[model samples]
Target: MSELFENYLACWNETDPTARRALIERHWSEDATYVDPLADVRGHEALDATIGAVQAQFPGFVFTPAGPVDAHHRQARFTWGLGPAGAEPLIVGFDVVVTGTDGRIETVLGFLDRGPG
Candidate 1:
């Protein structure tokens, strides 16, 4: 669960579109969906595009796990922070992930705790 959530943050920081897509392929189930305040997306292509857009918008920022993850019954939640490496976060959010029966991510529900100016 920890590794998977870390990959979620990695997806946020990955600047290479191909690499990010690969990450999505590796970690997400085919029927996966992601939703937050700003957007709702489904499938690998949409998830990849969403991650790419975020990287483009926050050029130098890296997303990192902000706290310990809690998981049970195929569901897990964790907080993440976004900023330059080693610096204070300008953005923060919590995400709840639901793993499929096969243990791949089936859904991600994100809640923004903070956002950059």
Candidate 2:
């Protein structure tokens, strides 16, 4: 479960499109959907583009796990923090993910716990 979150954050932190795409392919299902307060997207392409947009918006920010992940029955929820390295997080979020039988992410429902507003 921690590995899943680690890979998910790695996808967000990776600037190279090729590396990020590989992470997405390995961690997420082909038809995965992600919905948050600000964006809703489906499939690998949209997910990749959305992640790139976030990286562009906050050039040096990195996403990291903020708390322990709790998972059961192919579903998991975790908290995350986003900010410059070694600084307090500027954004905090919670996400619930559902995994397919094959153990890849199938859907992600996200919420903003805190933001830069």
Candidate 3:
């Protein structure tokens, strides 16, 4: 289900509303909640706005997986890097995601590891 996690990152980078929603439907549970240092939101629509806000704040940047996804027992933890395309990351963070029985994300807890200093 690591590929499912990859598509979650893609949802962050996606600018098209329709495609983003579709990805959410495929990857996240209907009641999923996302919590980070900046915000906490529940459900797909809220996740979409949170992601859209991040994308807007970092216009032209892309989010990339920082390393291999380490997953087991329906849960996964991974790091992600965000920055201008092809450049070193300006922001890096880790997130732990848990999936529901249906194989879709149920919760995401995020941490801010590094950023402009």
Count the clashes in each prediction.
Answer: 0, 0, 0
Per-residue lDDT tens digits of candidate 3, residues 1-117? 678668779888898888998998888998899999999999999998888888888899998989889999989999999998999999999999999888889999999899866
lDDT by candidate, in order shown: 0.89, 0.93, 0.89
Best-fitting candidate, scored by lDDT: 2
Please give, for residues 17-116, the per-residue lDDT of candidate 1 as tens digits: 8888888888899879999999799999998888888878888889888999999989999999989889999999999999988888999999999998
Q: Write the per-residue lDDT of candidate 2 for residues 39-97, one digit (tens) a residue.
A: 99999999999999999999999998999999989999999999999899999999999
**Residue 93 displacement in candidate 2 (angstroms):** 0.5
List the lowest-lDDT window of 10 residues for candidate 1.
4-13
Per-candidate TM equals 0.95, 0.97, 0.95
lDDT, residue 110, candidate 3? 96
Q: What is candidate 1's CA lDDT for residue 28? A: 92
Q: Report each candidate's C-alpha RMSD, comma-separated, in the order given.
A: 1.0, 0.8, 1.0
Q: Is candidate 1 or candidate 2 better by TM-score?
A: 2
